[model samples]
Target: MNTAHSLAPSQVSNKARVLLPGARLGLLGGGQLGRMTALAARAMGYRIWTLDPQPDCPCAQVADHQLQASFADDAAARELARACDVVAYEFENVDLRLAQTIEQHGYLPQGSHLLAVTQQRLREKHAVAAAGVPVTAFRAVRTRRDLAAALAELGLPCVLKTTRGGYDGKGQWLLRSTADAARVPDAVFHGDAAVEPAGESDTALEAPLVAEAFVPFVAEVSVVVARTAQGDVVSFPPAENVHQDGILRFSIVPARLPQEVLRRAQKAAERVAVALDAVGLLAVEMFVTADGRVWFNELAPRPHNSGHYTQDACSTSQFEQFVRALCGLRLASPRLLSPVVMANILGEHLPAVMRHLPAWPGDAKLHLYGKAEAKPGRKMGHVNVLAPRLEEALELLRTLQVWGPLDLPAPRLSS
Candidate 1:
């Protein structure tokens, strides 16, 4: 593994200069991550500009300027970069080439190499495994023959996922039987769901599918690590995550695990950050088996939903840490000030959430994304409930009763 300490002084010297207060910061995505990052940047006395397809995007509401455009618009990306001192992206799905283009016009502290590796699952898995992190067995499925071979090797109860443009449970399917395997088309396996057809650049679609063996783990956990341009690294405590229908439903901080397990998870996360030469935030998700084995599950090279508890529970929120890292500021301690539980508010829960809005206690901090419309399975907002004890926070979340009947079946937990 290539450690940050092994880099040459010249390589470190070439990094973008430290962006100070009053400088304008450009963000690539105007979703919740960008919105929160903008909020933090504004609080630090920096002007913010954002580019997103939605004119009324959440981040746009707080930004000094909003450039409404598609992620693939190279001209708009350059315009955003030219208008700001340094640029950062809140999501990983932004076009990798667009980021490279932005770098030519202005400083992109986070760099584009990590984004290129993370946008596709096949590449991401390979990167992680190459970094000496243990990952579940997986094979790239570019054709029906590949899928069949992977299935034969990995067996039933495995998962088939699109290599790119998948999040919050989109673009993946479970294969539990031969019938499930027979339903997938060869074209779907090879075509990228995120790429525009015959675009300005003839971007060939990479491997579009991946098949992985399913591990029946006791719990899912994640650690959010932030790295500065100077190679300083800091990470928050591991968060125990629970997902329902492939969407993260809740994150319990100070994950219920042995101290040894937590330490291992943290170390693995830090190693990933250093190996990727990550300059901003990177959230590493892992699975812990009943026997205490940890396996890499996924990687998000930006603010993560699992880290939402930090907004209310930590002295420095993840968004602030992200800004600090990008601007080359000293990283703050990611201490857990209090035990907390964060529950995602999906679109299905909005009605009940609004009806009980005034009933929530001060301990519960509600963050709505300011989206115009609510659809099934859409992440409309989240609520972080803090308490002196983890059990109390969990109880409060359970009794909140905001979430209605889900469209899909209840999430299956490991025995």
Candidate 2:
């Protein structure tokens, strides 16, 4: 197997003015994103070292070396840093302290400050808004009184979120009425969800949260952009995303949007990256309001779930872009290679539908995470198919004749 040190200097030397194929790349998270990164890196002649707590994490199964440890484990992170030339992140919720620990040994593209700030909703909103990008109206809630005040200011039908560790819909609450106040107890008990305070105890974890007046959006869309050390930047095609119960269900590429609106979305993403001096993939999620106005929703500094469709649809996938950026190489052009439809496979329906999944067309691209077990609403894999048009894709999906979602009964466990 190809290893980082076995590559020629052109491939793995960080001190070199330029990076070549076969470099050793270190990844901070070992989920599906890491697995995809390792696949792309290997295709480019690079090797991978991964850090994750799971012994059988999806990415660990394929990495050249896997350091099984918590994100907060400093000694293991140092060992991982020593094994790689440069480091990149997969998910945004990585411990800030862990990031700092790794930064001491090598480099983390997008930087610790970017992750430190963007990890929290209030700070992220403040930074994005300060950068002149539009965001939903929001206020910070520090206590029960603070929550009451933010509600008074932002009003009801708003979103309540902890500042630090929330993602994919976790650590968030929807407040529709006064009765929803009961949910506040969970956040207080959970502590600060978004921003982590320095020199603070984990027990006093509950800090200020953010409440935003939720906008009624027509659809959610995202643009994945990347920046390099040389200041080069590029954006992939916009994707129209659909969500259910706060998790992404489907992402359609070259999203069904007007030309002008598409341009606006790309511009908004580019604006944020430049403002942050961001040096890796930035997934900018936005709300295209019913009125056609585009509002910045949230930002993920690393590869994002919404951009997964790009793996099959784009000439340069986000994973490749990330590899290029973290290695300080010239950025690649982001262009759609085809019109595609991508659907997420959730375990919620997997048990009931596994028997029918094999019936899907052999041509469809099916990717399953090496997760050991399945649970309701858990993401198991995804399917991407290329077709002539969006309508055709949707039609093909319907005609595929799979059973689950609506009509299938709950699966029974075998003895």
TM-score per candidate, in order?
A: 0.93, 0.88
Question: Which digits, one per residue and each the tens of the lDDT, describe model 2 over residues 333-410?
Answer: 777777777778888656634666677775457778888888867888887767777666665555554423322111
| Reference-based lDDT, residue 88, model 2 | 80
Off by over 4 Å in 2: 1-17, 186-206, 401-415
Model 2 steric clash pairs: 22-45, 162-194, 163-194, 163-195, 164-193, 164-194, 164-195, 165-193, 191-206, 192-205
lDDT of 1 by residue, 82-180 (tens): 999989999988888789898788899888888887787877787788889999999888888888899999988889998878898788889998789
What lDDT would each prediction earn against the true structure? 0.85, 0.75
Number of clashing residue pairs, candidate 2: 10
In model 1, the Cα lDDT at residue 184 comes to: 75
